[model samples]
Target: MATVPSSSEVPPLAKYLASTDKKTRDKAIKQLAVVLSDPSQVTLPHSDMSKLWKGIFYCFWMSDKPLVQQALASELAEILLEIPSTSMTFDFLQGFWEATVREWSGIDRLRIDKYYMLVRRFVNASFRLLMRMDWEPSSCERYNSILAQRGGPLCSDDIRVPTSLAYHLADIYLEELDRALGISPEPSPSPAPLSTLLNPFFILAARTPTKITYDRIQSVLFEPLFTALTPKPDDQPPSRKKPRLSTPTYSNLIANACLSDPKAEGAVESEKLRKALLRRIFDVASGEDTRDANRRKMYNLWKSHMEDEDSSGQTAVDAS
Candidate 1:
């Protein structure tokens, strides 16, 4: 309901933009992020808003200070939820993607917490947008346009999948999938299908087969998720608990995406991928590392899913 700057205060916002001090510029970016998060302020047209975010994005992009970009990207989750329109969200996504491509590995450069927050919001905002709208049509349209839409992929062609971001997106999707499977201490009363819930990542996986490689599939996606599925020692505080990996749902997402992709061959590759996935899952779930009830649940799901896959003649014993 509030405006960023009532008519007269606009000059100060602009002046802050030009300030030489890093502190002043950082504060300006922070305030701009907050202002952009509001959907209620509709005075500015969507096209202009897109450019506004673009301008802000480039400021972060060109800035020598990495902290400034992290500060802006951190606001993405909240802004994603409150953005005025999907069009504008795409602009923000594009800006974020390009900035990431320039050099923004979550664990390496930025602190995990900052990167973690961005991923969590990005994935959730993506899914929420997909679920609310008929993205298939827009995706189809954008694909044919031949003009790259600003910000992340709206369609296959407009899509440019960053490997680092892709893996993190997959991680967040899997984590949410784990929660959706009703494995946690408090599962959802009504859960969405894994395919539906993780549609955004599926779109990414489907589009970016080239970027989503074997090593990344292991190191970035499976390894971290496997670690999370591994239950912590009971002596540890409940606050430190990792997410319970829903192996069955996890298997389902991969199978559905791989099978559906024209690039990914049938049962053979998908099965191999599944087995590789299960192998890591087995090590963590069945490994005698931690003694927690989740280990058994994970193993049981893995065993049952394997049987189902084998019965269908879709199970391949290959490393992912």
Candidate 2:
């Protein structure tokens, strides 16, 4: 038998993590969960965690069938919950985020949906973990900071990750928080403040360098409210049913926060935006003659611009 000399080689777990055989991958993940749940077994540094995430990313990449991918995603996110310590959980999450953002550009349309679901699952799991921690202020801030980081899904610093991921986050955010809070054990936990729940958005709006990205975030966060508050034209027929609103109770709170949160903008700029949005609401509600025509026109133009971008293949990025 010929012997091959070996120096540093691939980690044993990496092979299994990327295995195409379903059982092999599942077994590897379960073992990983155990190790993560017990810090004494393995202490993962940032670099090690990052390397592990590459294999885990491929694990999801190699998975076929939506149902199977979903199951795998849930299992992977659940690993965070299994981790014994807060620091480990945060490290595990940072590794996951870095890996996803690092590889986001290569994801194709066919595989994109699964990855989006994976992001949602991980996001929900994060909230659950925070709830488990009693939503400690420092922990919550750290969590939001990760999401708002330069290469994070929220993508404040660059366009490397498409804004679609952020849009999806905005679309599902409040509902996921509601679900996380609802599932808390009896003698319900003290409510996490609306301000904290909305912090990530404030940070993104405050710090995003591009107008397009800011407009995109603004539309996703507040457009529904604009629709709900606007009155239908007299000539238009009544709708069959009222549309379901998105976190309607928080509508005022979010608006006020956007206007008042010093972190979101300077006092002057915040006042200007506040007045602009308020005027838009009044104009939209009054059903009068072309009062908010410029905003309406600009909004339509932005919509068209987004469509053009999407057609040019700027759709989604995986945060898997």
Candidate 3:
């Protein structure tokens, strides 16, 4: 007698993932989509799943098809919501993340509006995982220190994708921060410090001075710090407790990212953008005012760096 297949045992999605033809691979994508569309499905084995992810990467990397990639991203977003799947995908995290970046980077590439919607899907998916439980995403710490070096080949790739993605991710990151840090009448639970959460993004903002990246860095990171550290009306009593993370994590992360980015090559520009951010960190980190004397002294270090840069600029001018 023939037995019926159990729910735990379904054909692996890898079969279609390996197909040579685009149509066949698309069929596999649709099949994965069908499975992910339902929350009850058990995911395929890790090896097969990685293969499936790599296959998706291969399909995108090897083709000129943005639609295919968009479909994969959309489906991956749903899969993540259903199952904790970043592990399989994270194995190739850079490639996985860069796929969309490369897609949307160039001026003549994907439409910004549509690209924005699609990128929202990607960043949101990763961010959801970032905030889920034990720890924040490690992408930033893993990448920031080395991104400008030859180690960060992707950073050198045009910078447009980084600019665009960084801009949007900042808003989302800050929005999440705001929600986590929003004022409450009673003591509220604060999420863990996003420590390195925005690090990867600030590297992008730092590595290049693209207008859009600059805007996002300023608005998302700087403006929010300013507002959060702003003095409240004295008439209103401080009813809520301070957040678990406080404002320093955000301020320090942005400042460090800016300072860490390599200076522009062969350029005579002053460190205006980087210094502006570092200098403000002094005020923001000062805690509700300059009352935090320790934080005030923190800016002294940056002040010395600014003077050093000024001296170097003058020397260069004299030599020229």
Candidate 4:
């Protein structure tokens, strides 16, 4: 008699994930998440494992279930952190973000919150991973492109939460860089510190309120005002052209300042500063000039700054 294939030999995980029933599909997704979480426990062969994950992603992309999408988002973040260099992970994340934005544009407030959290987790993890690998420029561009797109009427509002989350991620990026350079991660605890204007944007973005409030306006719109108002370092030369803030950086700044900081206390003259910075950013963002030209100018400025910092470090090393 011919040998028969057992249930154990079948790809139950993938099959279950692709099921028509919501309950069965969700259970399978959770199981897959667990398996992916601990690869050692996975009994599936390597080839089969690849197929299973691909199927899972397909299901993830095609399904309309928010619960399933949220699960997939968390799993994707974990996967990105677990395997930062995988091309598959990158492709999946890029596709996932695109799909998420499309779906998000059509949802109500509750759904928006759910989608925001899911996307935030993945984006945050990805940023941290990319920074750890010394991949800054690409990371910045990836985030910027996502935010730059104008969704429908809700698009602007929807972008706010993600923007704030991105800001918090940038803080982590800066902290990691400091640690790598053997510097203290903690800034001075002075009253009205520069960080006060910077730290909260990310947190706010990650936790944007479902209900609109006056506080939201202050946190999400006005707080960044303080950051812009505070003087750029004299040593930090103005771009011979315009300088572009990376998406992650810009998002982080906006979220922390505009979305998170409600009271806007500190730096006695913060209100004045906030207004100035807002005006400048608005001008650049809405300038009559082409968007591409504006972006190039911004990129050159950041590129130059990176070059300057690198050169300064090398010089110090050579002298030592």
Instruction: Please tell me which predicted candidate would have the highest lDDT against the true structure.
Output: 2
Those runs of model 3 whose alpha carbons end farther than 4 Å from true positions after fitting are 1-27, 33-74, 81-86, 106-110, 136-162, 176-190, 209-212, 229-231, 234-320
> RMSD in angstroms, candidate 3?
13.7
Residue 194 accuracy (lDDT) in model 4: 27
lDDT of predicted model 1: 0.45
Specify the poorest-scoring 10-residue window by lDDT in model 2: 1-10
Q: Write the per-residue lDDT of candidate 4 for residues 112-192, one digit (tens) a residue.
A: 555555656665665445444334345444444443334311123455334333433333433332232232132421122
Ranking by lDDT: 2, 1, 3, 4
lDDT of 2 by residue, 1-320 (tens): 32211212225676789898879988888877776786553346666677678889999998988788988999999898887777778988988888888887789999998998898899889978876776677888788878887778875666776777787888777656656666666455444444465556655655555566556655666554334334346885654435555324333323323332333342222334434454433333234332243334334533432331223433232211
User: What count of clashes does model 2 give?
Assistant: 0
lDDT of each: 0.45, 0.64, 0.44, 0.42
**Candidate 2: which stretches are off by over 4 Å?**
1-10, 39-43, 223-320
Give each model's clash number.
3, 0, 0, 14
Instruction: Rate residue 167 of model 2 by lDDT.
Output: 74
Count of backbone collisions within predicted model 3: 0
Candidate 4 lDDT: 0.42
